[model samples]
Target: MAAKTNPGRFFEDYATGQVIHHAVPRTVKMGERALYHMLYPARHALYSSDQFAQACGLPFSPLDDMVAFHVVFGKTVPDVSLNAVANLGYAEGRWITPVWPGDTLRSVSEVIGTKQNSNGKTGVVWVRTRGLNQHDEVVLEYVRWVMVRKRDAGAEVAATVVPELAQVVPTKDLVIPKGLDFTNYDFTLAGEPHRWGDYEIGETIDHVDGVTVEEAEHMLATRLWQNTSKVHFDTSARPDGSRLIYGGHVISLARALSFNGLANAQMVVGLNAGAHANPCLAGDTVRAWSEVLDKAETAAPGVGAIRLRLVATKGGAPFALRDESGKYLPEVLLDLDYWALMPI
Candidate 1:
């Protein structure tokens, strides 16, 4: 008897506006939260201590923002990027609500746009994915585009319509978690006294910390997210013969390193845009820096939104992003723009 298994969807199989409901709803717990901290130097006080969260008006500490993002993003891999060449970029990402330890999450993706590449071997597929809790509440949603291989290179082409995504999430659309009140935010326990007002637009802060990536850590982190991208696991997948570190791993590391200077900038509520400017491999020493982009007052008491440009580099010159020719410098790994909640 022949057994059936999923070979995953190829570029030719996807059409604009197609919706895919992913499988396997995952239930999170304290163990997941604990392991997240161990995997990265994540020490955001609001997500680490129940008492500290209570002080800010949350009933209890919620899972780290990256945890929720990884869990949700993982569920879509098998269905979306199982045979992808590379994840190109992200835009219009927002966390609508806090994901608690007990919450169960699942993902659904809608193919918003697709364009066949000139090479004919692959095409770009853009999807808007939503992560929803058990109660059907949307926890997060974002738009991502990936390069996917075609089942048949000679297949007839269709009209390519690339969806126009916002360059940045509007400040008015940012969601403040229920019961969040930073008015009483404790600077002493929060680890830094710098509030939202302390940061000047365009000010840059270099996080004075670096971590060398290891093969084991990269593999574990990729598996933890259930990310099935072959390039991240199979070294033979790339000509360099080096396993590429998951971009999310680098993002988390950069965010954690920024803690020394941005400890008070808690709660990542918006992701305006992100790009894995260059491939990150094991043995690379990753360093990070942040530039204040903009600021906005949130509807929640004591909670304000501060926009930042977080750049991760492989020992690049501090604040060095684009090269003289307008391309990202080879030493730069990630360039992310997002909004975080901080005490006003």
Candidate 2:
């Protein structure tokens, strides 16, 4: 009899136009918010205090945006990247709705493109994934590509199909959560005095705090999100005897650390593009910096959108992202472009 155990899909298993419904829906709650704060240096007041969230016109404190992202992302690991060599990049992401406490989330992914690497041992798969709440509403969506090993080195896939993706999530498409009014936002309690108008395009801010990633913490975070990828858990997955740190961990760290200067950039509404520039390992001290990219006026009461280039690095000089060749520097761990809501 064939083994009943599930062996995750290999590179050749994916096909363009295929839709996959990931298993295991998760019901997020206050405990997720608590554990998220404990895992990272998250201090955004809108996500930290129900009273503060209510004052800003939300019903109550919603789960941190990354919290919703991680939970939704975790459900897709087994089906998408359990056998992946590396997650390449993200594009065209947007948070369509706020995931409130008690919201049950699930994920659906459609294989949009695929290409066989010249190496013959691996291939790239591009998928557009959407995270939906219990009410069948899409809360988040993004496009990500990953490198996966071929089950058979001699296997041949269909004609290569590469997708043309947007370089950024257009400002007009950025979604502002319902009833989000930041006119009455309190700067003092929010922990920073900087507002939307205070930031100028082309300006950069170096968030001067660093957090060293611990082996235990990364593992805990991986389990918390139920990311069952072998590369992050099994040291033997790679030739070197080291476990890879999850890229989302670095993203949250960078976003949390940005609080030093971007405290009032409270809610993340859109993700333009992102790349895991390097593989992060344990014991690496992660630091962050942000450059103001663009800004737009939103229709929400006293609300505006600010676009920023948030970079996470390991001991790299501030504002240094790529070398002259346009390749990410070795010290650069992440390069993320996203839009956030702030009080004008």
Candidate 3:
């Protein structure tokens, strides 16, 4: 039987200096690339057209950076936060490198701080997680806080303190993938010429397209990210012997699918938050829906900021996702909020 774990824990369980090395290693492939395009309708010539990527001096367009982050973070969920009461926030997040198809990924986390809550039922644990590529180079890093349950409600309380963190990463800390030079970026195939000035706030878009994932596809994807969690790959390891799809795969596929309607969104600027509403399994056909949350002018001449809500569902008409509780359906795999850069 698969091991059972309680992700939620009291502050007393953590120490000022602790390290949690997550399990699983994932690998990326062309199937993921094809799915990304079908899902997002991303028209970034580099990601969509091989010729365009070559012109920009890359062997090929690599998988999006967010894809890597999602893969790495998903592996930690069962081990670190399955029982979490709340996710406080993130800090010091950075992408240090690019991830191409065929690359492997893994992750490790360290406890940076801890605090006891006055309520006594829960406490906060601060951890810094680092994602590493197959080459052992750091690809991404972020600090996050979670409210964990106390093993003993009556346990004596210790120190009550919280560590401070930056609200947003500085511009210099944003790592543009190596060899990325927009100098030769194509406006025609890239889908829009409206640099930074053309968007209005509160615009809603419907990205149209659907994809059905197979057990093989998700297993390969999770393995590429170096995420070896058995639930995602080992059917025999579970009571049902059914493999669970990686949440990041669904997120990446949904974001990529968002490209159909949001083709002008060229880069992700901010990530507000995200959730995987239900378990995804092989043989599920996935479709996407999106709504503009807000908009803002950016410093980039041709780029404007568009906040969006992206959702993914299984086997239904567009937007046909909700659960028995009348909430977002259980087949709905994701609900995400983020900011993207679009040409005005």
Candidate 4:
């Protein structure tokens, strides 16, 4: 039998119904909140001002849901998808609760299904991962699939069954975070009155701007999120001794960058999927590009729904991400899909 796999690769020396619990529990802090402000230019008074949030009846401005998701999801990359050929998709994703600063976050993934591809050299694995806060409440949960390479091309094929998944989560499945009472939601500070009705299908936005990340900024972010993966810090750990920038840093930066074009998207309604197309290191200037995929009207009087593709990359130019190989060049960091709420 082949030896155990490397830190992040999949090996045939595995079994079905396995459960992989990733290591490293993290705690969020003020540095993360500061970066969220700088990155997204998120004008939500609740997130930007503790006093404002308190006046609005919140104890404090909690981390944005997407930020929480990014922090939680980043932990799973090494153990789950480092060797993935393609990230198939997501289903049954929900943010069950809020993640406040100072909360510790950890993740656990249960292998829901596994199958061998007819091509013989590869297979697909499906997992349901949950993010729990320090309180042990499920803050986020999602089902995802990845195309993984097989250790032995000639290994006996187990099965070829593909699991069924919903293209979009049902409306009832949308778990609005507990204690999220938008009744007191401050519309003026939220930046726009546009709600679920104003966006037109196929609209395009140019969230114009970029921010160059520095060692200090990335390290601060990684530490705040409690993501202790040494590659993100402790530069002396690597052979070249370079620190790897945290992926959540880039995601927040890009989402914040999206504000230029998507200023009206006040609330995130759904997350269809996302990707870290490439690794980003410190000193890279990041910028963003957005394309509206679809739109719908919402029940919120002034709110509308807009599906958007948000892409981020390093210096050179906005929208210039891939090389001739059709691969995400070194500078490209993220490609994400999601739904946002805007004013009509």
The prediction achieving the highest lDDT against the true structure is: 2
lDDT of each: 0.92, 0.94, 0.67, 0.68
Error of 1 at 71 (Å): 0.4
TM-score per model over all chains: 0.98, 0.99, 0.65, 0.71
Error of 2 at 325 (Å): 1.5
Model 4: lDDT to the true structure? 0.68
TM-score of model 4 (CA atoms): 0.71
- Whichever of 2 and 3 has more TM-score, that candidate is 2
* Candidate 1, 107-208: lDDT as tens digits: 999999999999999999999999999999999999999999999999875579899999899999999998899888889888899999999999999998
RMSD in angstroms between candidate 3 and the native structure over all alpha carbons? 6.3
Instruction: Residues 1-344, candidate 2: write the lDDT tens digits.
Output: 98998889999999999999999999998899889999999999999999999999999988999998999899999999999999999999999999999999999999999999999999999999999999999999999999999999898786789999999889899999999999899999999898999999999999999999999999999999999999999999878988789999999999999999999999998888999999999999999999999999999999999999999999868999889999999999999999999999
- Residue ranges of candidate 2 with Cα displaced over 4 Å: none
Number of the top-ranking candidate, with TM-score as the measure: 2
Each prediction's RMSD over C-alphas, in Å, is 1.1, 0.7, 6.3, 5.2
The positional error of residue 61 in candidate 1, measured at the CA in angstroms, is 0.2
Candidate 4 lDDT tens digits, 123-152: 888888899988889888888777777766
Task: Give the local distance difference test score of model 1.
Answer: 0.92
